[model samples]
Target: MSLKSLIQGQKPLTISIISFLLMLALVIVIGLFGGRHIIGYLEGQLVAHGIDHNQEVIAGMQPILERGLQDGAAVSVIVSNFQSFIEHAEPFGIRLFLVDRKAGRVLADSQNRAAFPYPLNQLLDSMPRQLNGAPIHDLANWDGNAWRRTASGSVELISLHDLVVPANREERWALGVSSDLSELLVLMDSLHLHLDVVLLITYGLIGLLGFLVLRWVGRRYEAGLEQQVAERTRELEQAQERLIDQARLATIGQTASVLAHEMRNPLASIKLALSGVSRSEGLADREKQRVDLVLGEVDRLEGMLSQTLDYVRPVVRDEQPVVLDDLLDKVLGLEEELLSEKKLRLVRSKCPQCPPLRMDREKMQQVLLNLLKNAQEASPDGGEIQVSLEADDKKLVLTITNQGPAPAQEVLDRACDFFFTTKARGTGLGLGLVKRVVEEHGGSVQLGSASGKVLVTIVLPTAD
Candidate 1:
């Protein structure tokens, strides 16, 4: 798969784990480079310190040569004197030798053996060291040493040292020291292997710790995203419900419009005949009372038709700048008679800085009156009815709360739906009209119950 597809197919946790592993891999690579650098430096320091032993052998032999050369002793005498020193060092795996530049020979080795034509770097020189005053400019203290493998496949060290003998001598000599390093080499190999193991274990432990932390981060990230998706899903469901409600109401409005049109003319004729009969002189008192009752029922039917028609009608706005507090007080004054009949108390609160709003004045009054009427119906006898008006940057919020039995959850959910009501005689269009008007003016309605009180909240946009 392509890299993008590969990443898309993985869960957040797996992706995070892989990413952390890559980071850990990079860290391991850096550690490997650093470890090797440290080991190389350590090995150099150890070998250089070990090579100091080679110089010690040369220093010990210097004095014996100095004494013999100052006495004008033969080269054979110097060679014979090296026997005791070489024998003492034999147990330590040391090989001591001397190379005489004048004769092109190994004068004597640690084993008291001499070999002519020594094929080493120090022993052979083209220029004569005698009879020509040959310059002996080779170092007078010590030369550097190196690791070398012998013909027998054993590792050894070849350390060379320069000699300072009696002046005016017709010979130049260099000291040679060799030692077996197989045991030290084996120890160093083991140490390097141990270091590699330590690095591997340390990296494993660090990677495990990083993996756990990344897992936690991935979980939180996944949970947050899931919550957002759930919320969006709820919003979509709510929108679907709204569309369904609108479609149902549209179908109902069309049927009501037809029925109301047919019923109005027949009701008008019945009311005219009843009025004419009630004014007749021959009409009895009992007959007149029954006729009045019939007329009253007819009027009620007509009023119901008007209400239905009102709900069916679309809102036609008359935009104006209306003082919100004044309009509110006027509506409340009109409803004072109803409030008094039930002995219900109306408590009013408004923010001081709530500015004048641009909206349909008649519609605003209708919205407020419908809500007040609902509150009055829900409030217990002599219970408190609270109305509050608050404002913020972009909207005006109005809340109406009554001390009434809280409605059921289902009721609250469908309270604004057309023909949805809880009252016995309710036509269910009052709050429905209120909702339509408020929404038409760019607002929303919220119904809730809190502390056994029925609360209706309206949020109206302040923008023109």
Candidate 2:
């Protein structure tokens, strides 16, 4: 079909599918990046809290040390005060181990030492070396199994600190204090659970939304497919009807051929007899000219008969490659005189690089001529006819258009069938012949009205 006709008849499914896929892709991309952001934020919060809690524990020990150094209080007394401070500080599990600078003794404990015991050397050796002279701490390294009865059931952080006392001007005794972090571990667990639940719900909603959207898309796609199939089926039926009409025309043409053959000899003999009588009888010049006009009418009728027969004969499909631009130029050459006689203006354009198609050159020419003639007839004096060729990677398309009133639906429907016409003296086989020739070339012919113009298009497969 022609470019304008094909564009006007396009379905909306392709555009709809592209829009839906873009929406889905956008959501997927957002979810991927958003998930990364969420995970990064959670990890950052955990690390920040770990540092904060460790700092709080170390800072709490400063008051106890000030009393021992400035007031010259006993180490044992400072240790007892520090123990009382931890027991009431917060609900979090806290351990305090105050040992001498030699790391040999525990002065105070958060867990009841009577119930659970801790090995001093084992704890000190495990301290992280990166701690800048302060004791090491880790949230994941706490052990509750040693004091199962007193231990809260959770993974936790453990903080350790050593109490330093001056033994001389340069040396001091080192003591240890450790804090248990079962409560923060519990908070972390709760935060993780909340995040997981939110993620699950969000993903579920997204999945449900995607399913509904796809279902809606699927329904729309099916409806469009059905509509397209119905439309194509109707066109196929129309094509079949045209084929049947061509068969009938072939039948009529055969009959007319026989009748013409029988009448031509008698008509020629009568013309010769009339001429002889006019020459012998004192006929005036005007009377002789009138006799000659009668002969001309007979010849015109004979020519019309021959044209009708040619229309009925099925077009021979030519399989050779044809350059469509050259073919269009050839058709234009044949119709130039006719166009000039009608005073119709013709405008032509071609793509920069049009592909060749395998088609019958004669048939294509005939189709173009028939469409151009229709355009010329439809338009008023000095009306314009436009012709163009457009090619893509796979198909070559031709269009011919003329400004005119739209044809009635009934006329448009039957215009490409044999022997259908609206003109007073038209033979009415023009469009039918065009249809036969186009189909024989394995292309399609289409006709339509748009924007106060009538358009005809031909589409042929190309080798690209």
Best by TM-score: 1
The candidate 1 region of ten consecutive residues with least summed lDDT is 123-132
Query: On residues 1-464, what C-alpha lDDT tens digit does candidate 1 reach at each position?
Result: 89999999998768877888897888788777777887878767776665788778777787777778888998777777775567677689878877765555576667444453354444322311211233334423335575555555566665776677667787777787877777776777787778767886788678777787767776777889899899999999978977886786687688778878888899999999999999999999999999999999889888878777767666666655777788889999999999999999989997777877777787678788889988988888999998898897788899989998998999889888888888887788888888887887889999999899998999988776
Query: What's each prediction's TM-score?
Result: 0.65, 0.46
What TM-score, to 2 decimals, does candidate 1 have? 0.65
Candidate 2 minimal-lDDT segment of 10 residues: 142-151
**lDDT comparing candidate 2 with the true structure:** 0.66
Error of 2 at 373 (Å): 2.1
- lDDT to native, each model: 0.77, 0.66
- Residue 374's C-alpha lDDT in candidate 2? 85
